[model samples]
Target: MEAQRDRLVTLCRDAGIGQAELLADTLSLLLEGARVSVQSVGTEGPSARLSAC
Candidate 1:
């Protein structure tokens, strides 16, 4: 998790994003939620629907 956070911070910095840590954390949670949603539901779930857009 620490390594993932560090990588996210680096990516955010490279992308010129402000509040790197906060944005990384927020996006990480969103990804995690999407992953769990996909797992619990399926390809027809919210995560898949979001990816389609």
Candidate 2:
């Protein structure tokens, strides 16, 4: 998880995002939530809105 976060931060920074850390954290949480949603409610649930986020 730490490695993934670090990589996300690095990618965000490379893209010149001002709040790289925050964005990385938000993306991590969003992805985790989507994964859990998919498992609990199937692919047609809230996880399907991920592309809209």
Candidate 3:
């Protein structure tokens, strides 16, 4: 997971995102929340709603 986060950070940096680490962290949390939401409330849960943003 750490390696994947590092890779995401690199990608974000390459894309010129100044806050690459924050982007990576946000993406990680979003994914984790989606997974948990799916487990707890199917696909159309709060995470899915949040992702629509």
Q: List all candidate RMSDs to the true structure.
A: 2.6, 2.9, 3.4
Index of the highest-TM-score prediction: 2
Best prediction by lDDT: 2
TM-score, predicted candidate 1 vs. hidden true structure: 0.69
TM-score, cand. 2 vs. native: 0.74
How does each model score on lDDT?
A: 0.85, 0.90, 0.85
lDDT, residue 11, model 3: 94
Report the C-alpha displacement of residue 13, candidate 1, in angstroms.
1.1
List candidate 3 segments past 4 Å from native.
43-53
Candidate 2, 7-52: lDDT as tens digits: 9999999999999999999989878888789889988899889856
Query: What is residue 24's positional error in candidate 1, in angstroms?
Result: 0.3
lDDT per residue (tens digit) for residues 1-53 in model 1: 67887899899989999899998998888777887898889978889966876
Over the full model, what C-alpha lDDT does candidate 3 score relative to the true structure?
0.85
Model 1 error, position 40 (Å): 3.3
TM-scores for all predictions: 0.69, 0.74, 0.69
What tens digits encode model 3's per-residue C-alpha lDDT throughout 1-53? 78878988999999999999999999887767776887789867777776686
Q: Spell out the clash pairs found in candidate 2.
A: none
